[model samples]
Target: MSTYVVTGCAGFIGSNLVDRLLAVGHNVIGIDDFSTGQRRFLESSLKSERFRLVELDLLDIDALQRAIKGGEFVLHLAANADVRFGTLHPRRDLEQNTIATYNVLEAMRANGINQIGFSSTGSVYGEAKVIPTPEDAPFPIQTSLYGASKCAGEGLISAYCEGFGFRACVFRFVSILGERYTHGHVFDFYRSLRANPNELPVLGNGKQRKSYLYVQDCIDAILLAMEKAPEKFNVYNLGVDSYCEVNDSIGWICEALKVSPRLAYSGGDRGWIGDNPFIFLDTARIRALGWTPKLTIKEGVLKTVEFLQANEWVFGARD
Candidate 1:
């Protein structure tokens, strides 16, 4: 079992990865500043002797290098995970999401780490012209600063992988929904209904459709990609192929909550400045590697809603 350094280890996806790695008895060193991730989320893993948590910001190069020093591979997932927040505070988004990634790469290089797996997003393909956006989708004009930052990070990874001969995998993830997911559309809908028990805030006329991947599937693909990583850079699109619209997801949440909520819209058909109306990822390349998502959009959303309902305190504290 190789020692791994996982950035954003306290976040939803990172925490899940930690659980899996620990289950398999792999030694893991995790680093997170808890800006978006939570310390409480990793309490279970912290109890394990194989796990170590470094409470340091990724922007601190020395700290990151120290955390990653003896690790054989790095899983880079630290980021400003909110697109709306990116619109409101562009500088913070770029600095944290983009610049932090650059720093992580530099730290890995300094530590002589040549293997990395980056958690990228489908947002980089902003409003794709084709359905099931491929890995080589021209990386269309990204709208939000968040998307641009992710694209920039991907570019940096590619350059590093090629120039330094490191093994790297870039996963363009869709909307991830599952246990511990506290910030996606599913979580947002559940919170809104719980607060009012009657009114649900609907963004964009609710016509938006996109694939949603369960957290387990996200973890599975990451591990599989690492197992199948190439000597050079490799990028893959990951998501459940089927698309579910925003309004439809709201309906699912209401049914699960057993609440009849009035729908409220922000109007204008466009949800937000950087929102993509519809997107589907082509997982053929990753699927060709024999990795398949086990959860559909509905299954993922329903389970996520249940988790959100059961753990109201997690979302409640931030509210």
Candidate 2:
């Protein structure tokens, strides 16, 4: 069994990936800072002989290097996910997301590990002119400091691939939906609607439609890409084929909770500063690898709501 090192292993996507890897009998080493990721996510896996958990900040160069050693592949998922937080603390955002990525890449290089799968975002497109944005889409303007930092991280990885002769696959993700999402539009809606059951705070105008990928599908594609990854720098767009409006998602959340909530606008050009209004990913590249996402927006949302309902204790008691 190949040993795989996963950063941000306690986060939504990384934890899910670890579970999937363990199911297939892979030796998995997970490292997390527990800053935003919950330690509870790794609790169930602690008993497994195949699983190793290292609780350390990626910013700690020595600890990161030690954790990454002996891994065949590194899945880098640690990042400042809250885009809005960038406006308040831009340096923290850069340090955690961008600089942390640089640390990961350097650690990979030091260990002679050549394979890497990077997690980027469609936010890199920054006010895209093209519908269903492609992987090669031009990222001229980064509306958010968060997006710009990610773009910088991607550039660093791309250059490393060329400079160090390592193979890399960059997956530019859209809004990832599924269970275990601690924060996102859906999670927020669920929390708000559950609390009030009458009024929901909707960000932006509620007309911003976006492509989303279920976490399971995202994990599957990452593995598939690992199985069939090509030499040179390979970038793929990972997202659902259909786009759903923000208001539509709100409606779905209310329907799931059996509540009719009044929608209240938070106000803005986008949801917040640096939010993309409407953008879709042209996933033909990843789809060519014979990986198709099974969950539609509605289906994914429902499944997420079910998980949230069943695990009401996750966000603390429903009251």
Q: Specify the highest-TM-score model's number.
A: 1
- Tens-place lDDT per residue, model 1, 1-319, is 8999999999999999999999998999999988778777898999999999899987788887888889998999888888876777888877887889889889989999989999999999988998878988776787888889999999898888888877889999998999888787877777777679878888878888778899999999999989985548999898987997788888888898889988888876568888888879999988888898898889999989878877888886556
lDDT of 1: 0.87
* TM-score, cand. 1: 0.97
* RMSD for each of the candidates: 1.1, 1.7
lDDT of each: 0.87, 0.86
Q: Against the hidden reference, what TM-scores do the models get?
A: 0.97, 0.96
Model 2 Cα lDDT, one tens digit per residue, 209-243: 88888899999999999889765888988998889
Cand. 2 TM to true fold: 0.96
